[model samples]
Target: GRRIRKGAKMTYTTTYHSPLGIITLASDGEYLTGLWFNDQKYFGSTLTHNSIDKELPIFIQTKAWLDIYFNGEIPTFLPPLRYNTTVFREMVWNILLTIPYGTVITYKDIAQEIAKQTGQKSMSAQAIGGAVGHNPISLIIPCHRVVGTSGSLTGYAGGLNRKNELLQREKVNMTNLFVPSKKNL
Candidate 1:
């Protein structure tokens, strides 16, 4: 298979009408590159010159997945993701796939899981948080499932309020969900 070139920048943006509001979907040629809430503040500067064919298969798949998700169905479609990030960030993103629908995990939990997988005890939660913050694909990667150490809502690139709404829409009752105080490493 021909891989999309690393650092070969491209972008396209479109608005999705959802219960939350108009979500702007951005993409590189090969993958979904961004999902932003209409009122999100930090996303303005993140826009770039990368332009892709909106009619590409990956873009179409992403739109279909979003349609299923918003229509009260579990999103079963997982499209290929093309992200430009560090090796560690890629590893962290792969780990995100193991988190099932309607479930949530804390940043600290992610750190411990990655540490166990790599046998690197020094890998900090802060580092994992950085990788998560850099997630280019949004709902498909389910970055909204991650929370703070206190089991409270944390900052989401898409906006914390949107994150809460996503969790709620998925029927994840954060109030009753168990968050361990001790790291699982």
Candidate 2:
């Protein structure tokens, strides 16, 4: 599949302090490209060539979305996404939309949903995990809603603590929503 590129458009990067920690948000002229923790280990190996400015649309929209989300409101982000991935990744992201606000789903369930749509019962949950991790626009895409099969916090590129905070802030009952393989506290 062909990958979408941001091209020659200018990008802006900013760090916002949330309850989770410092989050780095990057945006092109039209939409948001990245949102992750500053100290996040998963993104440390990725190149940081994008510049930071305050004039991008994503910068404004991201800040607004963060405000609404932190205030215990369901954020409705419409930022343009530079999704660069395979057809499967795009399909996975589309399925992610069906997961409503303040709800959680396991990676296996996501894979099963995708399999139901595509009629491929052999799809692996690990592949779905890859798509979830590669999601560029975070909260809007709602990747945090994906958890472990045993209802554990599993691996979040944004960090498990941040993921827990997000789920908790959204008022998701962890005991009911997750299987409790491990506790943060």
Candidate 3:
């Protein structure tokens, strides 16, 4: 994950129309800083400065990436990204990037990976969930590929329905995955 520079100002934004909904993309002129569903929980939470509505090359590349994704194919390239998060969250988000298309991993799985990386005895799945939910870049980062243990679909900031749809579009098997009940949500 990359950090926003101290003197960086004037975040730029642009919107893309997607099957799930309107998505807002933010950039610091050269690198993508954020991508979120318009109505997502914690949408733009990482943005520290006001954004102006303008399209940058990064946004165009991202939209092209989304276009290919929505057409049911994985884009061979990745747009430049600058993650705005703490080190732990950045580590979690980096793991999210490794989840292949049409596959899923549990929060517990991520927690275990983090624990292994840090040489800790254990890591909290709930903490992993928090990091996953706060992911600044959505589809491209693949945060929707994360799930709970026991096949439960949980903690998607973009809404469970959108999460499910994104997975299905990637051709992920949904036979075992289920949206959790209200209490779990």
TM-score of each: 0.80, 0.82, 0.94
Residue pairs with backbone atoms closer than 3 Å in model 2 (clashes): 13-52, 151-179
By TM-score, who's the top model here?
Answer: 3
Q: Return the top candidate by lDDT.
A: 3
Ten contiguous residues minimizing lDDT sum, candidate 2? 41-50
6-108 per-residue lDDT for model 2 (tens digits): 4654566777777777777776555566777776645522224656546555677778888888788887666666655689988998888778888998899
Q: Indicate the TM-score of model 2.
A: 0.82
The CA-based lDDT of model 3 is what? 0.91
User: What is candidate 3's lDDT per residue for 58-85, written digit by digit as tens?
Assistant: 9999999999999999999999999766
* By lDDT: ranked, best first: 3, 1, 2
Provide the RMSD of all predictions against the true structure, rounded to 1 decimal.
Answer: 5.1, 4.5, 3.0
Misplaced by over 4 Å in model 2 are 1-9, 44-50, 176-185
Tell me which residue pairs clash in candidate 3.
none
lDDT of 1 at 136: 67
